[model samples]
Target: MRQIEYFVAVAETQSFGAAAQSLAVTQPSLSKQIQALEADLGVVLFERTSRRVSLTPQGRALLPDAQRVLRQARRFRNKARSLGFDTDIRLVAGVLPSIGAYFMPRMIERLRQEMPGLKLSFVEGSSSELARQLVQGELDFVLASETDRTDLARRDLFTETLWLCSTPEDPVMQSDAPATLSDLKGRTLLTLSPEFHLNAIVARLAAQAGATLSTEYRGASLDAIRQIAANGPEVGVLPSLYALGEAIRDPHFKVRRLLGYDAEHPVVFYTRTSSPLQALNARLADIIILEKQAIRAERAPQFQV
Candidate 1:
């Protein structure tokens, strides 16, 4: 079981040293266990060079099963500990860019209140990358805006509306509201990088509006765009969820509902299809759904997706 755990950890971390640190073991022992597991399985699980380690094809094929075994082992241990012993659970959660800002703190607070002994770690990245990590078994649960169905089972966390946001001081903000994309033909826009779904939305919206939108800068960080919007004449397209606090507090920034932009940006909580975290995933999912609705109820009148 330790060998299986070690193998999965190595695969998930992509470095033996990092896996050892995470597992709280020495590198040599972790390597020994992984070697033993490879021998028992009769396959080379990883291609290790001096600088890095990568999974082999056979390793990729066996990774899901190996992860399942480790999860079961963990569950069994927890079940035993529940019988008058201590059952401490460690959870690794991945999150999308925008959702992490507000939702994460609330979720973490709730988790601490419910499970005082829980050990939590978080990783934030693009929704697609986070989804891929979920599929790869690197994360126990992921809060994401887009669901990647490859190897994950997702529960809808919430849906957020999107809008066009600009600095109040900008001349365009004073102009008549844009009913169509073409209204801002030569406007400079700030948005997420091309790899993110929001960037694609901005592109398509521009094409439809017959506007030649030029992105001054593109990145995954919403704060960066907000800063640019605050500093320059760039119009920003952002999720209403992210733009809310700024809009409310800053006199210079305002969000305008994008006409015909009603699309469900489905924030989902995802886990591996077969893992012991399923029950925990369900609990987290319930919390997310409830909290998301509460958030939307307060802001929905002013926001549109």
Candidate 2:
């Protein structure tokens, strides 16, 4: 491809020195490339003398096609840029299963429409596991809870509030207004297993609200808590996105934000400090932000209620 470019440059200028100058390369390098091109094609492409350089008959015959190839290549590049990726980029990304369950489906759909050439294979795990994988160079980036690891660079994507969730027939759903911390004072809160950062948050909120945090039946995932709630009366604390998913899926499901508590956690994207994919990871975060925003818009009524 480069040889063809140099060939065209020399053909246009009809001088080695001029072509080299136009290409910002040494004349010898340009001449070498042209010679190599001719060697590769098995044809003599130039008639050379001290004062002039002119194309041979064979060179003239191939010049038009070579120019056509270069034109097609340019069009290829432009079209790729128009589609949002000039060159294809593949990433093995890690996400927290909690968010992945609710948000990844929409995110992936939007990503396909916006950047078809950006390929991603998603891995789901606890935050610690994801961070370990990232540090060991197993993942391109991770979307999970914030971490203070000196070796990892963190970018704040968004903050999501927590909601207390249960089936509509639960005693706590008797009122349509937002629930108060007082309402949870005597209840047992179902929660994710201690491996999750959310478990600690749930423990803290339980302590503040005078509720019992159930450890005897810790859930392995957010969906596990939802399934557990389906057969029991225990309330589960869930992040806004996951709670929104449950509320939308079941007409009898109920979620209530705490009236006096600001229970939100910051989400982050983590990668190694010296990662070659810094810009690409930032773009991924931007897309996630947009997708989350669209979700917020779509569920604005649920949020408002």
lDDT (CA) for every model shown?
0.73, 0.81
Candidate 1 lDDT by residue in tens digits, 42-76 = 99999999999999999999899988887888888
Task: Note the clash tally of each candidate.
Answer: 5, 0
Runs off by more than 4 Å, candidate 1: 1-87, 114-117, 147-149, 175-182, 213-215, 249-252, 262-264, 300-305
Q: Against the true structure, whose lDDT is highest?
A: 2
Looking at candidate 2, what is the lDDT of residue 98? 64
Candidate 2: TM-score? 0.76
Regions of candidate 2 where Cα sits further than 4 Å from its true position: 1-18, 21-86, 167-169, 260-262
| Per-residue error (Å), model 1, residue 48 | 60
The window of 10 residues in a row where model 1 has the poorest summed lDDT is: 80-89
Candidate 2 clash pair list: none
Return the top candidate by TM-score: 2
lDDT of each residue in 1-305, candidate 2, tens digit only = 99999999999999999899999999999989999999999999999998999999999999999999999999987865544342477778888876778888888788788778777788888788889899999998898885546689988898777777776678776676778888989888887787777777778778889998887565457877877776667888888888878888976677787654546756888888988666667788898998888888899876752
